[model samples]
Target chain A: MSTILLIEQILNGLQFGVMLFLMAAGLTLIFGVMGLINLAHGSLYMIGAFAAAAVAGWSGNFLLALIASLIAAAIFGVIVEMTVIRRLYKRDHLDQVLATFALILIFSEATRWTFGSFPLFLDIPAVLKGTVILPGGIEYSLYRLTIILIGLAVALGLYLLISKTRVGMRIRAGENDREMIGALGVDISVLYTMVFALGAALAGLSGALVGAIQSVEVGMGEPVLILAFVVIVIGGIGSIRGALAGAILVGLTDTLGRTLLPVLFSSFMDGSAATTVGSALASMLIYILMAGVLIFKPTGLFGSA
Target chain B: MISKNAKRTVKALGAATALALSLGQVAVADGHAGKLKVGMLTTLTGGGAGLGVDIRDGFLLAIEQSGNAGIEVVVEDDQRKPDIAVQVADKMIQSEKVDILTGIVFSNLALAVAPSATAQGKFYISPNAGPAQLAGRGCHENYFNVAWQNDGPHEAAGATANKMGIKKAFIWAPNYPAGQDALTGFKRTFEGEVAQEVFTKLGQTDYAAEIAQMRASDADGIFFFAPGGMGISFLKQYADSGVDLPLVGPAFSFDQTILPAVGAAAEGVLNTAQWAPDLDNDASRAFVESFKEAYGRIPSIYAQQGFDTGLLIASAATKADVKDADAFRAALREADFTSTRGDFKFGNNQHPIQDFWVRKVIQLDDGTFINTAVEVALEDRQDVYATECALDW
Candidate 1:
């Protein structure tokens, strides 16, 4: 209705898109290099949330919790990669899916066993608890603004790590020709482990950051996992840039659609009818966007053909 | 064999009547020879397990408090599926021969099992999942609910919201029967403009988009009807969205099961329900304390309802003079028990005619969250279809 409200909605969409990007980056990387459809990726996200909650509870500090969550998730990822994931790497996609599905059960049950089926609370630090006034007289949560900034930083950092580093070179090589990379005596097994750990760490970081805004619980990683899958599929599988682009795209579409669709519908219909139609359409907006993108550019906006 | 069966039935009925009068903890156990077979079905492993576990914990604690009776509760995981619940119900009835069927966390499961219990002539006292359809047109004689009907609490919230002069409100719920019942129940009481009536995905985690939409809407309050993990996730996101709108919901959102998960985000949220841990009564206090002592957590409404289910069935068995399912069903319809919800009696529809209270989450002296401090008592809360419930008696 108002310019200010529209601007606020757009900002909200951008923040949501960035959060999706954080989740999509790791999943795309794992899928690109490992050629394994890891269904248990959400479990790693849960691991990060639990780790953050535990560390934050212990130290009474948020920064320590964030660092600890990433490290803890990375360690757990490497351990899982070595033990269960490695066994399925050479196996078929069906086997990998089943194995990872089992991991989800194991992870969820284990977390429930430890946490006793209660959700843990992660607080936003006092510094980021208030609202900030934005341009156009719009108000926004400081914590969400921080997420957008942190998400951008993560994107930049990931870009540098993948494009500039020696490990990045090997990862790119591995993605192109895994057999040749292993044949060149680069300890491909260790490389795979590290890559998995890196993805896990990123997922963990996202979980920790997002946990402050959502309830940290046993299966919290799952919905995010689905969104990340959409992101990668939209951006182009195994493409970081594609993931980033696609995540933002999906996020903005989802947020904006939900906010504006009802208003759009209300123009012709009554309020109640508009709301019912609007909300239903809003829920389907992202998948519709994905379908449209697929129709035109099948590999995704940034995915390699 | 007919004479012997008749005598056993008379004896069970006599015990049930005496037990209600006697106020004995272990009221009726003579009917089930030695092995007290109890089948407990709840959502145990998946998303809805949060509520299921609470119900399970309550049932187990009641058994423990009753000195871990001669009864063996064979727990089955329903996973919140109606079809799975039916299978579990069949197994409990046919194979396990569970003298009592209790502990259902969702209404769909309750509906599936309630009809079957009536057909099979077993006493099915539901701890939770008071479905609307059953409370009205399809009301069963054998099926009894320890919990209030699904509409009861939400109706209280809606009434309270209207009284507070909250003119413009937003209603959000999952797309299901219970969700429909919740919003409908709320709208029945709250005569206000509903800015948006949205149905979210069943297991939706992110509320950013919805929250943003609400921010732009003209609504003064947001009413939500998400339970278990869904409630926890939605509440946390709603809090973080920086909308200063007052939040109100049913007791399901801020119960002992989900309070810990949402933590401080749940603080100051108002809810309407039949049971709170801090209800001003000796029975409620004792139940809460004993439950906490056993489970290392506060007892939720789920637990209270589950415990009530056990008590209801046992009391029924004592009254009916028969340990068999038919006698117990008859006795349960009599509905003679003083429950944790305080002086609740069964209506003709076999649903609870109980008081719904407005409850708020306040920090206890131990720095833990609780739905304490009852504000108002909405008595005899029933469904919109209560008029449709036709009973002979």
Candidate 2:
């Protein structure tokens, strides 16, 4: 393989990793603050894509669509938090899982009803429509590059929000002790709602950005949601820093493994057999990594004992 | 005394109603003119729902146009699962006692359900999902396919690619039976070395890794079979990746239902199919116009197959009594129906022998992508596996 190709593949991995971070961050935050496993997080991602598609179709403005996605997902998230998710806060993990799983079905069916069975269109803006020539003369999609940048910016912004702000301080306290924070005169319910909405908005942003490249359709979020779950589990659930690290790790492993394994296997065996084995192994690479990590660090890379 | 007497009267009334209902069922089943219960089993949820929805709409449209009052259709969602399809087929066959079964959009599901239905002596008129196994040694007397075999369009694509003299090409497909058949069919006629043949996960959305590999390959052209969202994702990503190779595939990738979602990325791509909306035939034009009016979207090839199946069944019902298995099978074998695809005929294997057209995705003045028939690629094409069928009836 060419050095240029390797560099490009690495970039692809990084791009994929950052997107996972966007998804994992929200999931970890919700899990950390409320101890609620929200399986419907992916549904929020779908909602964001649908919202962006609808808004872009009507307004023909990418900025407006992005704003619409965030607001729509955030409002929906808050409503879900208030109505259903709040009820599951004191319940066992099984009830939380079942309730959120039901949300996924409800959201998917409702989206299908509204958008019809066909996929909705979300175009990359004109400015980001083409490729950019990197220093090594390798061409990369500008839109994808933009996604990486946006993801990194969001990561940084999340760090700032968590470490430097009063709301962030309250969140940290709540994560440490929910009842203690409530006893200390903080409106714990409102804090949980805001945190849920924030996580949802982050998911929405990722969806809107990724939806331009991928087909915006129903059930589009489940695959990414699974990956995000892996990211959190590996990164140590509820750690944004860990989520970022794990996302990038999983992304690079997946992307590079898919590209390189076949080439490596082809050297020893026939081309077709090598490719079959290589691709199969490549898809399993992430899970293997997760397994390896869990074997050593049972709580994840940053999780508490 | 009053309560006991009331209970006895109620018991008598209930028994009488049960007797009447059973008698009514028998009356409806005994060659009743309009009582043909058809089970429409298709994917109506998840990723494959679009194709199923189209098939359902077209099938229903044809049924409505026929004004067949006795054709009571029972629709069920299979969710694109083979197990679910088999269960639904059983329910329809046993509980609902549907005389005719139709509307399965995927080959895997059809393979699971069609054989069992045919074994029970029920007429299995397939609107879509023509697996090669059923067209060959597995062919049964009671089963008839309204659509072409799974590899029909792919074979045409291969022939077209060879005719265009493309020497080296890269091929990709989802990793499944249909995907494997697609590559095999493409290679049958295209006498060129494949740069690479990659099998991706069925519902994989991101293609950056695949596209990057394709970009680096020394291939002159590309052919892929990624239906539904997979196609949309791959085409859009390929367009953005600055790969300028000529791309070709079966029409499933670039059909009307998905073309709008694919947008500008799909333009100039060539695909092969047995039918297109612009095909100049009375049935084709009428079906397209009415489909748009009914569904507000141009019908995909799945819908055309469904419509044709409806027409085929309706014509057969008029000629033969469905209650008589021999007569119904004979009437259906006559192939006396107007098809959206002109010159449709049934081969010995009960699969369609039809012309396949090479269609290029063209953007109209209103900025909608539609497949325009560029040329007839293969005329009166019959599946290669059809000769293996030993069924004489």
Candidate 3:
């Protein structure tokens, strides 16, 4: 790969990593503090994309559409947490998984019923539609670059919310000792709801951002949900920092593996064999990375235990 | 005494109703000699539901128009899973005792059910998916594919690329049986140097890595066989990636069902299909009109295939008894129906031998995108695998 191409691929990897982190952050928060596995996080992502598309269609304003996604997903998150998710936190992991998995089906079917079976269009705004040449004559998509900046902004904002703020301090305490935080006169349930909503809004934001480029369809959330799970698991189940690190690692591995492996194999094997072997290996690269991480650090890169 | 009397009356009523039901069944069976029980195992729910819904609606529309009460259709959702498709096929075969099986959307699901369904003397009429194995090595006498072979459109895409004067091409498909068939078919006829041939993971939504590679490859044109949502992602991302190369592919990406979803990104792309809405034929015009009238939307390529499958069954039903396997097979081989695509016939492999037309995607005044026929890609096209098919009549 040329240096310029390599730089672009790295940017691509970073962009992908940040997107995963958006999903992973919320996932780690819920799993870390609430000790609740939220499989429907992906559903929230879908909700955001659909909401953005609906709003964008009506308003013709991209910024308004994005804000609508955040608000819509947050509202849905609050409702879901209050009505269904609250019941599962006290239950076993199996029960939680079953209930959340059911939520996924319900969300998918309901969305399909509402939106119809076809995918909806959500194009990138004109201002961010084309590419811009970076320093040293490297051309990159302006929208994707915006996505990276937005993701990093969210990450930094999340850090501030979790560390500097009182709620963040309470969250840390809850992660350390849930009962102790409750004893400290914190309204633990309300805190849980806030954290869940925050995570959900982040997921929705990422969804609306990526949805501009990808498809806005039912079951679109499921794949990203699976990747978020991988991201959290690799990053350490409840650590935002680990989620970021792990997400970047995964994004880089996947993008670079896909681009480079086939070329590397084509050097030795025939064109067809190289592509087959390389791509097969490339798809498995993330899982292999996960396994390797677990082998080395069973508690993930950031887990305390 | 009153309770006992009521019980006795209820028993008498139940017996009378049971006898009448049995007699009614016998009468209906006697009424139509060429009656067919068709079992439709299709994707009715989940990600691929749009295609399945089209197939089911179009087929039923044809049946409804034919005024054929003799064709009793029983439908079941496969949910787009191969194992579920197999289970449903078994249920339809063993319990429903359907004489014919049809309406599988994906090749993986079709391959799972068609072989076993055909082996058990159930006639399998393929409407959408036409895998290469069933056309060549595993060609069954009872299996009749009313749709084009899996690679038929891709082959036409190759020819279209040639016509477009694209000398070097970057071709890609998801790494699976049909995907492999697509790339292989594209290379079969195109007189071009392959800039790159990439096999992506099935259901992969992101194409930045591949798009980047495409920009770097300096290919004259690009041919991609990403069907359904995958195609939408590729189109949107490619349009945004600043790579302004002309895109060419088969019609799966540019069909009525998804073209609207793809929106302006797909406009003006040349794609190949066996059928187009603007085909100058009575049946084709009628189908396009009635389909829109019935469904409140334009019929997709899959729907056209479904209508033809239904028509094929109806025409064959008039001539031969469905219970008689040899006679029914022979009649199906004749392919006596006015297909929405003009001049449809079956090759030796029992797949469609029809003209492949190139269609340019154009947006309507209402801002919805659809394809119109521009030129013929291949005349009276036969699947390349037909010669290998050893099914002797």
Candidate 4:
């Protein structure tokens, strides 16, 4: 394989990884603060994409779509939190899982009913419509590059929000001692709702950004949700830094393995056999990495030990 | 206490929505003289719902246009799950006692349901899926496919590629029976060296790695068969990546329902299909006009197949005694219906021997994408698997 091709593949991996981070960040935050497993987190992602597509179609403005996605997801998140999730907080994990799973079905059906079965179109903005020549003379999509930058900025912003702000302090306090924080002057219920909405807005932003490059349709969030779960699990369930690390790790492994495995196998075997084996192994590469990581560090790369 | 009351209200609302959604599926009976019961099972609420919705809509439109008071349709959502499809099929056969079974869109779901349905002496007139196995040794006398065989469009693509003189081509498909069949079909007719054959995970959204590999390959042309959202994602990403190669594929990817979502990414892409909205035939024109009037959008190939299924059934019902299985089956074999596609006939295997056209995606004046037939690629093509069938006439 050419060095340039390898470099391009890595960039693709990085782009994929960063997007996963956007999803993982929210999931990890919700879990960290609320001590609740939100299985319907992916539904929020779908809501965001639909909101973006709807806004983009009406106004033909990418900026408006982005804002709409965030606002819609946040409002929806808060409503879900208030109506259903708050009730599940004192319940057991099994109940939480079942309730959220029901939410998935409801959200999926409702989205289909509202938008119709066909995918909605969400276009790349005019300014970021083409490719750019990187340093190695490799042409890359400017839109994909923007996604990477946006993900990084969001990650940094999340870090600042958690470590440098009063809301962040309260979130940390809640994570460590929910009862104690509630005993203190902080309105823990409102704090929980805000935290959930913030996480949802992040998910919505990711959905809108990715929706431009992919189809905006129902059940788009399920695949990403599974990956985000893997990211958070690998990163150390509650750590933003861990989510980033785990996401990049999973992304690079998946991308590079998929690209290089067939070529490597073909050198030692026949073409068709090599391809069959290589692709099979490549699909499992990330899960294999996760298994390996768990064997070595049960808490994940950055999870609390 | 107030918050608890609010929670109860919310719970009630959720329950009401669920109840209403389920209630929507309950079939309404319209009293008619002749009895022809059809159980329409198709994906209605998942990723593959677009194609299924088209099929259901077209099938219903045909039934409506016929004003066949004898026909009672029982529509159910399969949710694209094979197990669920089997359960629904069983209910239709045993409980509903529908005379005709149709409106299955996926080959996997069809494979799971068709065999059992046909074995029970129920006629399965497929609206969309035409698995090769069913055309070969698995073929039954009672089973009929209104659509082209699964491999038909892909073989047309291969012929088109050969005509275009593509020396080296890279092919990609999702890893499944249909996907494998697509590649095999393409290779059967194409006289060119395959640079690469990539089988991706079904429903894989991201294709960056695969695209990178394709870009680095020395292939002059590319062909892929990714339906629904997968196709939408792949086309968009491939366009964004700026890999300027001649792209060709089966019409599933560039169909009318998905073409708008694919947008300019699908422009100039060649696809092969047995039906296009622009086909110059009376039946085609009427079906298109009526379908548009009913559905407010251009019909896809799946919809065409559904309409054809309805036509086939309606024609057979009119001519033969549908109450007699033998007469109905024989009449269906005569292929007396006026197909939306001009000059349609059935092969010995009961699949359509239809003309496959080379279609190019073009944007209309109203800024919507539709496929226009550029040329006829294959004429009256029968699937290769037809010779394998041992069915006695």
Give all candidates' CA lDDT scores.
Answer: 0.78, 0.85, 0.86, 0.86
DockQ winner among the candidates?
4
Q: Residue-wise lDDT of candidate 1 within B1-393, one digit each (tens)?
A: 112233332233233222212110101122233455677878776567767778877877666556534656778877666777898789778987876678888776787787886688666777888778888888766667778778888899998888667899988887666777888889988889888787776666667667766887899998999888788778777776678799888988778888876778888878988888888988788888888888788888888888777666556544654366556566777767668878787777777777888888987878888897567747776556657888656
Tens digits of lDDT, candidate 4, A1-305: 99989999999999999999988899889877886667678889999999999999999999999999999999999999999999987775556766887788888879977998899999899989879999979988899999999999998998899999999999999988889989998999999999999989989999999999888887788778878877877887777899999999888988899878988999999977787788888888988898899789877888776
Candidate 4 residue B266 Cα shift, in angstroms, is: 1.6
What DockQ does each candidate score versus the true complex, computed on alpha carbons? 0.21, 0.24, 0.25, 0.35
Question: Model 4's DockQ?
Answer: 0.35
Per-model chain A TM: 0.97, 0.99, 0.99, 0.98
lDDT, residue A72, model 1: 87
**What CA root-mean-square deviation does each model show from the true structure?**
11.4, 9.7, 10.3, 4.9
Per-residue C-alpha lDDT of model 2 across residues B232-291, encoded as one tens digit per residue: 988888888888898989999898878989898998888999998899999999999999
Q: Is the docking of candidate 1 incorrect, acceptable, medium or high quality?
A: incorrect
- TM-score comparison, 2 vs 4, better candidate: 4
Clashing pairs in 4: A236-A303
Per-residue lDDT for B226 in model 2? 88
Tens digits of per-residue lDDT, candidate 1, A150-210, equal 9999999999998999999999998888899889999999999999999989888888988
Clashing pairs in 3: none
User: Which stretches of candidate 3 lie above 4 Å from their native place?
Assistant: B1-35
In candidate 2, which residue pairs clash? Answer: B34-B70, B35-B70
Docking quality level of the chain pair in candidate 4: acceptable
